[model samples]
Target: MSARRRSISFALFGAALGFATIATGPAKGFDFNIFVDPEDNYIDASAFLARGGFIPVPVIITEPAVDGGFGIIGQFVRTPEHPGDQPPRTMIGIAKTGNGSTAGGILRSGNMRDGSVRYKYGFGAADMTMPIFPFGLDQSVDYHNKNLAGFANMRMRLGESDFWTGPRLIYRQTDVSLGEDADLGPVASRVRDQINNLFDSKQYIALGASLHYDTRNNPLSPTDGINGVLRLDFYDDAFGSDADFRVGQGALASFTPFGEDWSLGILSKYKWTNGDNPFFTLPSVDLRGVQSGRYSGDAAYSTEVELRRQFTPRWAGVVFGGYGESFVSHTKLYDAEGDIWAYGAGVRYKLARKIGLDVGLDLAKGPEESIFYIQFGHAWGRDMD
Candidate 1:
């Protein structure tokens, strides 16, 4: 399946697994005031969670890339033992999309060893159907994918600093086959042969490391500060992988607050790969309106900016735009024909004031399509760790 399908499926599976392990009941005499921020009187979940409440947040996945879907995620957060320590959290849920895709899994994140170390890990399985446009051709072919994947990462904070570094491991096994009813008619034999060769079963194992620096006011959401990461992965036969390749990725995001009611957020990312690797593993231009894997190559880069205005104590509005490109060679990056752009607007609600968490919706338009996303936290906040 395509990259977007895999992402959607894994997200659903992980959430379902996590939710399955959690058991909670309505609190007796649950105080409604806990849902409101004390300082600003805005609706929020900070107090309720701080008071040991478990929240079952509905997951509304509307990205056109995955054909849209819905699910529920149950989140349980534990207060930190110390003032500056990281709070531990568990999340679980499941989801299915209109395209007959489904998944579930569990995730845990927290600090250890007196806040010196942080860890996140999860496992999930998914079955999905996705459309693949081969070799940038307008014609699309359907493919079915079944996969199980897992990953774990551990980072140690540099003593008294904002930097952290860590090792990471990932494993995945996948089976891919052409959709049973797909019709590839009137196509050239060479192109047909290429498509026929794309199906297979594969196992991948990668070992990687990451360097990170963060000074954001809040990890879940941010009004100001900078966060950045650089990571490298090596997938090799020595690691029990079917292919030998190296991948590198880097990303940076910064938020700047202007006065009390305005803020600006900017994000940039770059990824590249070398050596023999599957086409689906190539770097792609990731943007709001573009489907993942629709514009993929050996290297890719993208940047986006958002300007936000706080309309009220509980509501905010934002406008954003981005540009990206994917190219077969780094030397041709500036002149790549795959260059694309997207722009959009959205509104946000302060769902957890104390933690700076926000929920919102956005509608974006790209070169080919318009898409909407039901976003939790920052839209550019994925894989920040």
Candidate 2:
């Protein structure tokens, strides 16, 4: 979808959600969730399985904690079938500063500590965010260890709202591990220059801005809504000059039809890469695709349409199918344009007013994959921005 189209779609989606929340008694409070995704056996070598969610509690400390509230969240998940194995446990400490910027504070798993500050000056016309953190916190499972790692993410926006069209600038540095065990190791091990490469060598710094419009229903408890996000990116490698700072763009559209006893939605994604690109920042959902960063060096797109109708207020049935293809640059990949598709049905169960749990079995290309998806904060593909 074009940026204009995506913006319009998002606006409509947000509006729907807002209307739902206002119409429905305005539910509130914490949410605990868990879900499993299993597509690891795909030949593309990109899929995997995992599950976890936040702890539901009254720890939220801000009004509409859904938006700018802060609290502690704990959860865990596993890959069981990945190249490396380790059941990771996570504990996140969150603190919100305000609503002017999309920034906050985070202390995760003890190894990663980050602080973010966001502010808007000049009558909220200009906005800025600074995120600073130290890595290598998760590498040590035994003793509390320290390592050489640090990076910063900075963005400046000149827009009245977070979703307004504007120019943005970002800078990041990822590879610089010290005193930490090599990835998949406990202590004294090789150092990974970048974090993503620590597990699989893929790292890069991306800088870009986009023009967008977003309108969606209830920021929370959205059963029916719509959203669209469009972005353009320029990526530069901190390690070497592999790609000429590849330029890429992503377009997405999603919507849930209103008032249907059954659910119907459409999600579309399109991404294009310029040159030899780093694998980490590919515009694809992890474990949701056949390959991780599978469409890095070329152009690719995918679209899925789903219809879900509820038999009971707590139970709903859903059916979905879609196709996607990626090429190593339109010309070189001639016969290499890989295609993927899946179709399936599932049951959704709602818990409390803010959470929905779904279990499904999808046939990917031919093989059956089981998936348990969860809904939190907002519906899938919907962003506050």
Candidate 3:
């Protein structure tokens, strides 16, 4: 072949490949999405990085410090070919909120079969404000917390179903600083001292087994299916943990489809810790738009339901309401702020159809405050299930 003829042929071939990719990209479910809060009001902008497969894309984002800023909740994850999954690529990022609270972490994750597995180990630090004094006059306190947490699990398919029985281990070292609060100081100090090593830094190892079942249509945004997890873990000094305790936790979610493109998702979570464990490490009312760990206790449980309707091809509307509370004793359920109620409405845009994931914004009202969330993943969230 002559040099000139070969060069012309190569150019044509390259052009053909580029055109093919552009044609099929949408069908393959790859896209980028961005949005701002107060959808109609346009108060702030929100964006995130979520890519599947192996596309080497570089991203540098700077979010202006306004309306409590933003944080990296969860990033784009790799998709598996079949029921089993694997981890994605190595990732690292940082987040800063508007209320003078900042948090950041680095993660290395993947699944062997190239599926989705919520397995990652990272370190994070946050300076936060908690409304821990529901019975008191202040109703809020400022605290600083730093922690290193890791999730490592190995699973095998069970009985031709998406359910998996696996042994998993969780580790965390939390060092908390409960600073002075003139209004709630005395009571807060007494509560902190009651729990051994609660005010200072503490480390605990959770070694246990989990039975997880997930049949959600989409790992990202499921219009149907059930995802549930039952976990029993133990922390003891024998495991080099500063506190000895037994932790039992379970979370179950089910999405049902009803009238015309409408789906109802119901999710419930329960957690209990027995023994000398740091007060902050227990599970709290993890609801939408609520302050992180705003309500925590030795035992906690909650249930929430969200109804979604596909009003448009790429848009869906969501309305959700839930109630949860944490308490040291059963009688505390009647205490002030013991019963936490939250509800909100939001809009969702199908961010990426391939994974069936949706990006959404919700305006939620907690017990005594209202907040907004720009969700990277579905509200039901990710975990062993």
Best model number under lDDT: 1
What is the clash tally of candidate 3?
A: 11
Best by TM-score: 1
lDDT of each: 0.73, 0.34, 0.57
Q: How many backbone clashes does candidate 1 have?
A: 12
- Estimate, for each residue in 242-282, the C-alpha lDDT of model 3 and write its tens digit: 88888888999999999878999999988887777665555
Give one digit per residue, the lDDT tens place, for model 2 in 1-385. 0111111011111121232332243233212111111222111111111334333222232221112233333332222232211122242322332432222222222111121112111100111111111121212121111111122222232354334443444333223222234454532242333542443322344556565444444323344555555666666555332344555454554556657585566767676666554332333321231322223334667677777777765445666676766554343322333456655554443322222222222222211233333232222433223
TM-scores, all models, native as reference = 0.85, 0.46, 0.72
Please list the residue runs of candidate 3 whose C-alpha ends up more than 4 Å from where it truly belongs after superposition. 1-67, 71-76, 83-90, 113-120, 123-131, 134-138, 180-198, 330-338, 383-385
In model 3, how large is the Cα lDDT of residue 292? 55
User: What is the overall TM-score of model 3 with all chains considered together?
Assistant: 0.72
Question: At residue 21, what lDDT does model 3 achieve?
Answer: 38
Which ten-residue region of model 1 has the weakest summed lDDT? Answer: 17-26
Weakest lDDT window of 10 consecutive positions for candidate 2 = 1-10
